[model samples]
Target: MNNRDEPANAVPRRAVLAGLAVLAGAAACSGGPVGPRRLRIASSAGDLGAGLADLVNRHLRDVEASVVTPMASAGTVDLIARGEAEIGLSQTDLLGVDASVTALARVYDDLLHLVVPADHPITTVDDLRGRRVSVGETGSGTAVTAGRLLAAAGLTAGAYVRSERSLDNATAALTRGDLDAFFFSGGLPVARIRELSARTRIRIVDLSGWAGALRSTYSDVYVVRNVPTSTYQAPPSATIADATLLLASASLPDALAYDVTRLLLERRDVLAVAHPALEALDVRSAAATMPAPLHPGAARYYRSVKP
Candidate 1:
């Protein structure tokens, strides 16, 4: 029997049970857990950033990860620092000491390439004076390194007419004879550059001589590395190399960071299948993210796996 004090507008008991049953049925038909955590990783389009994001989505059941391609390492770092992306792939030199960002791993090294037409007379950095050059897109790690290298060689901004373009755009412009030279920093044997070489004869200028100048100003973050002559069918030359780092927001949960770091290393073999550069990942070297400390969660994973 209903109490006399019951409100006249109160729903009947049977009706309430029917409504609950319908809600339960809808949930059952949904077929997956509700409210999975979402993560966005920022990286250059068609680069390691996209590949790593694919890895995370395939393995992590509770987290949904996606890649946001800003097409520049400096752009990636900016995204992570602004809390727009949970993870990012960036060049080590682009990552200054920032408390908001933490490293997950040192993935690989990006070799600097100074591309010019085979017929062009320019040989040394000094020869770039009064020439058409692209220092890389604005806010790119390539631009930062290129500017520093040029300055080290005593070429000021006024020394050359500089245009900012992405790797693809610069390659196209160079092929059309619109640009004399452009700087690009990428993993060994960049596919775009290789394709450009096949269609148009090109040369990679030697920058090894200026490595010492760069190291003197930026410390050991810059190093000398050789690009095999066979890769681009260009003359054998050495160029500056810098580490590429995987970074994350410092505020990420310790458990999630640990899980992410663990997946990255344990599945290195599998990831390497898609991104050959990932084969260079080593725990010892990865933990040495200088200038940017490892996230505590990442550090925990390293300690657990120490031999």
Candidate 2:
């Protein structure tokens, strides 16, 4: 079992609902009634998006106009453009890359922690020089955030610090003494980080000073935060880090997107249980979270929502 301890089935616990919606899409594509369409939401299984998939489905179940389909992790831009999934989690950095999809809501932030072996020679993002690093899977938000942050510090992918592997594999490599440092984005205290912490000494590199500069370069989309030492049982108590997380879709119907957004706002408690960070999700800050524009439909909701 991967140290995740989360079940494979647990990843898309909303499979039945999602499968039904997939069928609905196929039916619509095949020229069926396409009546009261079901909306499919693509989320990386076993990731933070997956954790919220169920919460989203539960709230969306009663909406007769549409259904929310949960999907495994794939390309966020592709899924939305192809109409395979109407809603999916997107890296905040993807705002200008495509004009097709739009931001329905602002999900919580994915933390970009620079991890290293406890005794390693690195203490900040700048110290990554002359060492091996993992910037996350290519085409991943991790790569975007890691690359930009490193660039802000005068480095480049595979140039300044060699990117070894994805966050999952990199964590394993780090434990085996193969990687010097790794940076990736995900909900705080993610399973991978927790697993690594249990077996090897690890730390969330502090990046408070450079955050402002990074924000300027990467779009104010990246928020600066401090992951408490308590987050991973590390040595320090407070440490600043970069943020990377957002939600979007190019295919989601404006009305349907509005409903899903409304659904989440109404059921704050359920989402809070999955990730405490969601406690801060709100309509007002939704657009500010994305580097680009918010979905026109979602923008409508945000404007009408007072306070």
Q: What's the TM for model 2?
A: 0.71
- Residue range with the least summed lDDT across 10 consecutive positions in model 1: 45-54
Give the Cα-based TM-score of candidate 1 against the true structure.
0.84
**In every candidate, how many clashes are there?**
0, 1
* TM-score versus the correct structure, for each prediction: 0.84, 0.71
Highest TM-score: give the candidate number: 1
Q: What is the lDDT of residue 132 in candidate 2?
A: 84
Q: What's the distance in Å from true for residue 101, model 2?
A: 2.7
Model 1, 192-256: lDDT tens per residue?
89899999999999999988889889767898999888989998889999888889999988888
